[model samples]
Target chain A: MEKKSTEQLEAICSQVRRDILRMVHACQSGHPGASLGCTEFFVALYFDQMTNNPDFNLDGPGEDLFFLSNGHISPVWYSVLARSGYFETSELKTFRKLNSRLQGHPATEEGLPGIRIASGSLGQGLSVGIGAAFAKKINKDDKTVYVLMGDGEQQEGQIWEAALSAPHHKLDNLIATIDLNGQQIDGPTKDIINLGDLKAKWEAFGWEVIVTEHGNDMSGVVKGLEKAKSLLGKGKPVLNLLHTDMGYGVDFMVGTHKWHGVAPNDEQLENALGQLKETLGDY
Target chain B: MENKLDTKYTYTEKKDTRSGFGDGLLEAGRRNENVVALCADLIGSLKMGAFQKEFPERFFQMGISEANMIGAAAGLTIGGKIPFTGTFANFSTGRVYDQIRQSVAYSEKNVKICASHAGLTLGEDGATHQILEDIGMMKMLPNMTVINPCDYNQTKAATIAIAEHEGPVYLRFGRPKWPIFTPENQEFEIGKAWKMIEGTDVTIFATGHLVWEAVEAEAILRAEGISVELINIHTIKPLDTEAILKSVAKTGCAVSAEEHQFNGGLNDSIAQTLIRNQPAPLEFIGVDDSFGESGKPEELLEKYGLNAKNIVEAAKRAISRK
Candidate 1:
């Protein structure tokens, strides 16, 4: 229940990055690039930004809720949820193992404490967020809904469909963040499919667009999320474009799509862990 | 036996099953505060206007985004909201298959996917709008319950019934006006077969619009002294195996009828059930692995071999095989 400072949050982010690397390396499966990239944002939300209960109620009434649309980055989310006391941190070892609650993608079937729905399919979280936002409004709970999606996921037609309806329905209680890492599994997002003028696209879709240059920076994410939260009830859904690195903290894996899904080898994991401080003991 | 098999039941007026869904949804909203509705730009078509008007705050107009509507419906379930998504059968199942599969079915969210304009009975809208494979697609999902109610009364009861039940459900109804033979305000029991007539000759298991055809086929076969046992198998997934096996055991022959493809419709479920339990001589009356063209509802039914005559012929063929 102790409030975390910006420096404390950064240390947690580093530990989350380590958790992501170790979890993926242990499974020999999972997408680590975005998971590491969104570590700061996840830490900021769970530890600092989101007003949530660690007890983990499925409906999340009277509290801020978050959804992972680009569910491939579930390692980072699972790490943060466990670190934030949603469940025991020791459960991180079971990530992607048989009968593990932490699947490759976030799912609720295992009765995971934090996940509200199964998500790995792209472009679905925003819609689910909008629904939760609407539900909050109906229940007279003034809580906000946060969703994280991949830049590559914007190509999915359903994302645009959700984009058009969120603002139309005046879902100001909803705030969506896109990890603009500029890299996807195939290659660079521009080469795969350029998302020209993301800010313009969101503006045209009637959302209040906030473009942040430093998504990997803990202070920047905390600031951007605070600003997005401040803009609530303004009759516009907020869209935050967080510019981040694909393989953020790991030196060898950074700045490329090569590590988008591949797990780090034993030596590579040791090197990655060396860069990411184990401020909070490793799971 | 309680509902009098020998007495013939008929309706003076005909109504589309979709209207029953609309009425049932409105009633459900009235009954439960948690019942909510979502539509993918097909409110009028899905007969959801009444629900929308009555409960505008709870009703979500999701535009033409069937995929988003489905995911949102799944999300709504997290808050104990029983969301009923409305759209055409094609958009409901085929268009958003992965969305429903991942977000709703796999997540085990309590969602009701109310699909209208199902099967060839969708009339002149043609094959693109008329979804004949939705029942199969939905039934295959692990946590999905598939229901294809025959008439307005049955569809209404089924709609209201699904709202009370937990987990995901696919309620498939048609756009065309059909006979309303089932009782009004009847309690619809999920996965239970409705036996309209009991006979010794053959068991005619039908669903959706084809149930009416089976009724007519029963009347014709009864005149010819065939003595048919006409059973309405509304819930396709939890196939009333006991009812099917019991009826087929008594008759020694079966005819499965539906307004869907013969490959993966009610017939396929009945076949799987019979193959496992009481193996009986079976014939299928459905679209013979072909897409339907633009035509009247009645014409399309006749052309696709989903009429009373087709059921009668299938019954005779099954009896002969037996």
Candidate 2:
């Protein structure tokens, strides 16, 4: 797989942001805040970073796997997966609707092609990622396993349980990233429960830590992912602390937790879509 | 030979069901290389040492982190690995209910959740260690198969059998040395009831350690001129409705005995089966909505109304009601 250029990936990111706003607007419910906030990271991961096949196989041998721990942000994932040919982009309209395969949370029960595990519940994906990485090692697949989680979701004790196990078992094939968007549902993560110096915390747990301040930028995400991949196979699991806003690419929704779960109304949706270029054509 | 119930069964030896799990897991590892075991710091308690010894690379020693063990076990299925997680029943279900629900059960992952030291027979470990509500918790899950095999041989056979069974399974066993009555190396069938004795007065539906207690109750009932039909309901979730209805049709009354709580274990399964299909006179022999305490296994069973005396009394009550 050839590495996608920054220009091409950025265009895809704009389309994904548009799709997120539109999908959430259509459903009249969803977490568009984190979905928009993590656009560049998702675009970078699916389009450029992972050696994944959209022609998805449940037992993905010799391929890198990704798990969305912060699964409430399904709009972004559903859009990216659809755009990447995992499914039709038209299915984006069916998201969060009754009897739709695109559930409010990503689930394998509906036989969604890109998803391997159901992950609406937070703090579980890292462990699942570690398990998949362990399986890779056992099967001699020699591929990476990546998990993306929310900053507020770090409050869950199971995250730390997984954090301790990963390095103890020497799962260097595992790469975990926390979307340090600062804002959660109630308020800023610091105001709710301070996640004081996550980099230090991860290092103390025996993980190789990588901090990317430009998590909302395509080039920065791609670079962070590449650096994380480069540091693999060195006897430590990798943790990428990705810093972004609560909502990115839109004017009003950005930098606030108010839009964490509330959908943009029709007028607000038009304003949001106006900011994002329809580079890849709207689904 | 003089009494008919005396010829029903004979015990040559007593062995812990966890040892059967250990032996069967070792055999499962040999049969299929994809089989892997993960334990949360209870290798000896779960009897996972033999499998760990034979296939050291395949076994994962997850140091007291059961949630992570469960999550990882679910992930292992994505890569075509058959993961059997080992722990005490309390930790396996109650401790990590959310983990099992989302990662394994909801996802329909092929992970075998093998739990030991179930029910009141966990003995001196007391109320905290003993789990009575695990069957209720597990059976309620949409894609979970719940099995509580009777004796050592049956537990061993169930262990091997669940490996071939696809999707998630909760195989419950105990810590005590139980009478090995079922045939050695018998092919354990899931969701199918085992008819230990064919009779007409009352049907004794039993599971886990209480299966042995039900056997003893059958003999006593036989001597009292009451014909008791004994059935070992190993699988609890997909309750063997056909066998239950058939037995009830002949017996016209029912008694359910289990080492778990009366509300959610074998009794509930039997009651639900009977009510939906054939509503018979049912009497339950189990701990009636109460927790357990530190005591000898037999003493606890006797104290909690989980022994043959309770079963015999319950059978008589059920028969009298009819």
Candidate 3:
């Protein structure tokens, strides 16, 4: 809907990646792989697609709402929300620490402006998105609702239950995006639990499914999101399957599942940061 | 003692707690503009047909997805709207345990998880549907308010009461057309026990459909020259500690009954309450750790030791201990 230069967006995303590393390293605990993999998507979604007025505070009266189903990737979401004016970027230091608003999982209890509910346990964001979409429709608002889920998290039966019902209820205003990284906690996705034909599975559930080759590719992300927006209000929900690299910018962390929840120690951190250019100022 | 808590209250022949929840939800929709209902495939079983038919726009038939239903309920609470999600007790708690733990309970959303067909009374469906551990599962959550009402009127009242209260709550009831003994207009209050009869020898704490059997046991005991105090422990999480301690102080012994396993039903709560506050000699009336099977409701009730005779026997034993 709104176009910001790719250079600026890319700069912002690089800062987000730094924040993700710092946030995790500071806490000495947290998920950084998926956060690094999905940083560009969050940056694109927050800076480009969503119309959330963090400055306005519509009382959630008539604002766009986003739910993070895969809440373990809180580092990227917290960074993006802060950089987008939801809060100060300095708040990134408090992530996953005691008495911090940024918890390991996203929750509304901290009175955070962007997060509507607590989510870390997976396979629940779509239903929460559907409920918020229904509320928005009931309140006569044209704003849309969005949610992000992990590809492996689709194994949760509740996600499909919500998937089948969203189209049945014709929640066309809701759009769900999946980070299809093809890896989970144990090993490769197939080794852990093969999710056969995810695109066909969603299509079978009667959703308008879209696919992107690179989740971090800004131009592709913008194009895919724009196409998803055009399909809205067509009497069906939208699903975007973004094919993302496991560690996106970091060469070593890419294409593996071992780094899913582990925080990089001092040596690994230096190696990872070496591969990723500090294009933007570090947190 | 025979005239204890006269049953002159007018109620329909008998009705499942699901119907009461449905009725209460319809009333809530009419009373509050922000009340919305979401169902996960078991709409017909949950008695949400009336709500869907009346408010097609407001009722969201969420197919067979319990995960999304929980998340959506949390999202609906973002702007001060109250969302009620309905489904079987098994799927409502066990199937989507993490969803509820994170999205709804930990987040502290004002969503009502209305679970029907709890305990062994979910007959014919057998062990898969009979979820006795749901009380313990839901109560363990930090911000969740666990309530298991006795019958149709009480369940309906609880449904209405939860919509008014602003927080996450789990309202548990059952399938069978239980004896609707409570007054029609009884105002349901959370964390308060309903004293059906006054006695000083022993106290009987009951919840859900077992409340009827407990009352019957009280009548049977009265006939056999025993004065038994009957207390309906509808809300389990907020266990009515004051009422339980006060009753146990006078009657230094207690009996707990429910249509669930002895592990995590009303008995465990009563035991914990007494252990924490006032220690009392207690007897438990429930099924042991065993799975249910396909059978008639009354036949299963008798076989599982959840009938009036079990409560009466437990009361006699409790009195002996005192």
Q: What is the TM-score of each candidate against the true structure?
A: 0.98, 0.99, 0.92
The sequence of per-residue lDDT tens digits that candidate 3 reaches over residues B71-98 is 7787787666798999999889998888
lDDT digits (tens) for residues A1-283 of candidate 3: 3578988788888778878887888888998889989987898889987887877352377767788889999999998888888888888899888999998888777688787777887778888888888888888888889889998898887788788888887889999999999989887888778998989999999999999887889889888988999999999999999999877777777778867888888887887777666765665
Docking class of 3: medium
Q: Give the TM-score of candidate 1.
A: 0.98
Q: lDDT of model 1 at residue A4?
A: 86
Per-residue alpha-carbon lDDT of model 2 for A1-283, expressed as tens digits? 6777899999999999999999999989989999999999999999888999999998999899999998999899999999999999999999899999999999998899999999989889998998898899999998999999999999999999999999999999999999999998889999999999999999999999999998988888988999999999999999999999878999898899999999999899999999999998998
> Candidate 1, which CAPRI tier?
high
Share of native interface contacts recovered by each model: 0.75, 0.79, 0.77
The positional error of residue B44 in candidate 1, measured at the CA in angstroms, is 1.9
TM-score of 2: 0.99
DockQ of each: 0.82, 0.88, 0.63
Question: By lDDT, who's the top model here?
Answer: 2
Cα deviation of B70, candidate 1, in Å: 1.0
**Per-residue lDDT value at A259 in model 2:** 97
Ranking by lDDT: 2, 1, 3
Ranking of all predicted structures according to DockQ, beginning with the best and ending with the worst: 2, 1, 3
Better of 1 and 2 by DockQ: 2
